[model samples]
Target: MWMLVNANGYTLAPDGGNFSALVMDGGQIVAVGATDDVRLQYGARVDRVYDAQGATVLPGFVDSHLHLAWLGMQMNMLDLARATSAEDVLAQVRQRASTLPSGAWVLGANWDENRIANRRMPSIAQLDRAAGGRPVMLRRVCGHVVFGNRYAYEQAGLGIHPANPSDGHFGRTPSGDIDGYAYEGATTLLERGIPAMSGSELERSIAAAIDSALASGITGVHSEDVRHVGSLYRTMDIYHRLQAQGKRLRVHQLVGFDALEEYGEWLVEQANKQPTIEELDWLETGAVKLFADGSLGGRTAFLQHPYHDAPTTRGTAIYTQEELNHRVAQVRKFGLPVAIHAIGDGALEIVLDAIASVPAVAQRDRVIHAEVASEPLIRRMAALCDRMIVDVQPRFAASDLPWVEGRLGLQRMPYVCAWKSMLNAGLYLCGGSDAPVEPIQPLLGIHAAITRRLPGTSGDGRFMNEGLTPYEAVKLFTHGPSYAIHREDRKGTIQSGWMADLTIVDTDISNSQQLEMIPRTCVLQTIVGGEIVYDRLR
Candidate 1:
């Protein structure tokens, strides 16, 4: 059945002017033109007609980097995103612990040491007392760091006496006693013991994530959660089942690098067992993800120089340049694309060198969270053009601005969220929420990109001098990201022969406004595959 959607204003393409109407049939956009012309062509055959009532309609947002299952799991956890003191964190932990059964793991997220009044990582003793002996583990906003109570550590079989840290570290005092904080590789101590979600539970969480995303105008996401090596098959089965059920969300799953090494043979075998690309239309396999460094919020991002506050420590890197190059070569040999998680300048340089080693023909390789890219690196990135992509989270700067400035100093902080610079340099940039770290709202992200201020910043309302225009910001979330994942031909823009994935907004977002008013710009309707998945009017 055909559908005719007439809106007062419609962005037919990222840069395309507003249109009055669009027509869709069999899940594809059949035509987009004047309202009267579209009506004259398909009005009789159309099964439904939607009146947008002067709202702005555009392509549904494409979030390039997110953890769908984890975001869903976070819906039930303690939210400490705005806690101003360590006491606030303990209080929230204590409250959650009081209601839970004995021995049940109490996990939480979004607590940052930088924001705490004491400016210290939470200790095991405090959490132990808060939990009254119940095991507790709290993840930092970046998800790269974790803090555990003594009972939680003991349950994971970690000893009080600290051992030599591996690629990542377990925080310790001068006396070599475990101090609750665990970074990167060390997070596995507690993560290994946490109960795994069942397939049904995973499905439910994914569905919840999908609904939440649709409500906020996100029709597609590139999820990068490759479960543990041993559970790869089970996780893949669950994903396959979800796809078979005709899940509303479009997903581009990137296989974890850990699985590539631990279960390489099995992964290759499974790849061979699966049908060719044509047969597996809903899923694409051949993208390997690697974490080259930790996150800035955790103060673990690899840096060429020491942090402004922590002068003695220069942060850390997971793989050396040579090692990364070898891995890149190996992945390319297998005809797979590589997506490296690199946040700091030093880390990005390492990844860039590895990318340069690969043949230029391999397109769509990306640097996830290319946050602090330098001028030279930006120039090199421009050379790659369509081949290199960036998955950026604009909201992070608004929330982390104060702390980031404090850590990097004012001179270096301006370069933290370099969206405008990247755009000017001709780099393909994709916008993502990095959910569980930030709320999954593309509108909020778009606002942050253009304004560089939180929703309620006082005074002149300028948080960062370097910011993007709304038109450019919209491209980052839509066409820019679509191009990154090689989906521009089918999605990203509203054109004839494209997928009918779109969002209708209540206001014209391109217009300048007070920072506070940005979040209230609700998505009135979200349509995917020619179906109205979410409609505020109804």
Candidate 2:
């Protein structure tokens, strides 16, 4: 047994209080209480003890939504997210181009046109010059759009003038030539020409994400990987290997979204091949993922009305009402819970109606990015106990909220990120960083949730009244995710009989005055299953 003493701990219990010591043995917390008494009883037999040095400890963060594969992909790829202008991005691209073999693909991710000082999308001619004649592809931060160089267009077999898809688009110049821009599924055309990652390369990336998560004090993550990178078997293979190596991190993977016929067939084919487990403790999946719409940042999110800024057009819809209902019901027939990406209000209405149509087949069905749901939609979601959950990224506010108000206007801003209203309406809320989309750091998430402001930025919050309290905000990353996933009884809290996963920090979060420091708060230690996985002070 081991004890963590000389500190403050927030249990996230219904009847919350301060605890001084946390005692654990064999991957379970044995006791938690005042240091003097609990230590007096267990000190004699305790084999090891961690002195907190008067810091604040809490249950380790459990992020309910993120793409670990994508995060890993970003870690090793060309990152244009920080480039201040188009020229800066091109300068970096040229540097990369100088090193790669000619004709080899140059891939990049996280490029946002809005962040560029000129606010201009890079043109194909500019990209060609930057890549020095090599094929180049880069995805927008939202992953809904892509930019490619002339060589990439040539490799993809695109013609001089390419017609756009009915649901998505490709940019064209005044001369009617392909502009090397692709939106939505059209981006996949260019992607197909790129080489796929090797199995060992994928394992290395997943391993990278695991180490990053642990270092950030994350104990568990509800991740989506197979959809973007490789096959489900490939994704789970590395996870199983990690478990075999005794490197365990709680992961609830959501099956990738694809066409109804293909995804359905693959599910049954992989069922018998899946490795049997004593319980779904380390890695498990019973949830099927779907994409209902695009992202707000890309101006592709389905909305009832046209964007206030882009009044000429409303956002794109991945599926219509009937299409969604029919597909959702068919997916439910397989007995798998569904999680859909529904960012705009139009998508929410259709998704909620779809879930409502299906009689409760599972304990939880998730609404990823319920970013903009209206009042009536909230009420309807409350009625549906298909246990529909709202998986949100508060840090998204830090990024999107800055310009979302301009797109939505004041009349619509209040309804956006109305987390308080959703809770009052009896809807469940869980937090995720949508990492690589946002940083996967939970303290930054907590800061964003409570403050609704970008860390280090000085101003009134984007929507100050929509912000959550410190306790409520913390729950988004803790009990809220556990309950959403139906694992609350065993995880998500620091208490007796619960899983021994704790995150220790050097500051008090409950003080309210310390809220601004939440993002800056450093992780002193991360303990997972009674074992020290990450310790910075050491």
Candidate 3:
């Protein structure tokens, strides 16, 4: 019942023919053609009209990976994502601590030490000073390490000294007293003690996250939030409620292994009854996630070779090949899409071998990071594209660059962020922000992809050989992701049969000149299913 006209938008074709108008009715695109052509058919019945005002219009972005509940929790908690030094982080903690009652837990994340002057984590004594006798649980930028204050240790019932336990370690003082840093499973001590969000609180977090995503022009996200929030059933119930209440953002939920183990029978029943994706829907849950290894920054990623910087240790592998293969087979048999974290080449090979052990399926089993993919793996993955995909974060260049060559060294540098290589290898390359890890802005990721360098910095990129064109980068967010989720038929483009999930930007993003300033180009409006979900102009 609406028409959008006079936009400098493309139909997303190879030639990208100029289009002047679009028609929408019943929350779907009815027609797209010249202004007169669209009006000739629906002129009399159209209830409202909108003008693009000469801005660029494209498909709404899809973040192939991210954590929503964590994003929402960060919104409610203190944010030290921008802290550049240990003192700066302590200062932020001290400020937040002053407002809280004594013994309250201070929670936040996105703490990157690379930006710090000395690039060192703050000590427990410093955190104690900043936290004012309160418990503090701050996740590192990588999410693999958790920093806690003395009160956190006290609350966990561990005395002044705690040793390495289970699959993780705690940094201890020379005298054997517990330090702030906890790694891998050891961080669970702090997390397990934190209170879970109430039902109402979870709803609020989901709503806040949806609004934020819409404002960023993200119509869809593949979210892994079960462990970050609570039970899978509870989260799904909340999503259903939000959908019934008319939430617009599309959600592709990633079920945790724990959730599958706990509620396998119930989930199987629900999957059978899940609605078809013939039309654009608000929420769907049919994906399973497994962690193959830790993170590059955390130095726990399972590398085939020892890290150049840390040659003494290779890293952690959460599951053996047999174990991972068994889990993959189980999920595949249950008709669930699976995505495994594989940052290092060692982890990538394991996932590939496991998937290759079984016949190919169209479920789009994926290697989530594959950051350190090798030539052989690339070739094999290309041969397996009919069954698998690679979901990568372009903005990782911003964080990993300047040091990637140090950790990965020269031989592996070419393979890192080799999106074009992935494409050439016949792999579908979807992009994401990995928000809370990287900023959730689609433009930021695009800028990183097209430039492979931080904004405002010099040169084509640190790795100019690895850069992707602006159009190709955009497609990673649109076409690539759509294909990965089996919605390429209707979700990723601006065609007559496609859903009317469109994003309007203030500038022409495809222009190479604009790539330099793309991060500054704001989302003028985000339309989902022909309804305006976010409108800066309004």
lDDT for each candidate structure: 0.78, 0.83, 0.82
Write one digit per residue (lDDT tens) for candidate 2, span 1-538: 9888998889998775789997999889999899999989999989988888799999888888988888887787798888878888888789889999988888898888778886886678898988988998988898888888878878888765666776677777888887888887678777887878887787778888888998888999999888765677777778988767765678888886564455566667667667554246677775778888888888888888999989987788888889889878888777777899989999888898888888776458989888998888888888874477888888877788888887778898888888888888888899999887888889998998888888998877876877889988888998988888788888888779998989888888767888878888999888888888888977
lDDT string for model 1 (1-538, tens) is 5654557555537456878888887778888888898888888988878777778888878888888778888887888888888889889988998899988989898887777887765567888899988888889999999998888878888878646456688888788888888898889766776777777777677777778988898877877666531355655666677767756666777778767764466557867787663333345544688888998888889877789888887687988898999988887766678989998888988998998898854448988887777678788888877687888998876787767866777777656888778888888888888886888999989888887777766644234556887777887788877787677777888888888888788888876663456678888888778878788778
Clashing residue pairs for model 3: none
- For model 3, what is the error of residue 319's alpha carbon versus the real structure, in angstroms, after optimal superposition? 1.4
TM-score of each: 0.93, 0.95, 0.95
Residue ranges of candidate 3 with Cα displaced over 4 Å:
13-16, 158-167, 174-176, 271-280
**Minimal lDDT window, size 10, model 3:** 277-286
lDDT of 2 at 228: 65
Cα lDDT of model 3 by residue, 1-538, tens digit:
8999888886675545668889887768888888888888888889988988788888888999998887877788767777888888888888888999987788878787777778887888999888989889989878888888888888887657776675677878888788788887788776776767798898888888888899999988889988876788788788878877877888888888778775577666666777566432567665689888888888888899999888987788878899988988887776677888888889888888888887656668888978888788899889888888899999988668777787767877877877777887778889998887888888899899888888888776766767888878999888878888788887788888688899899989989866777989999999888889899988
Model 2 lDDT, full chain set: 0.83
RMSD for each model, in Å, please? Answer: 2.5, 2.1, 2.0
Model 1 lDDT-worst window of ten:
277-286
Compute the lDDT of residue 367 as modeled in candidate 3.
82
Alpha-carbon deviation at 469 in model 3, angstroms? 1.3
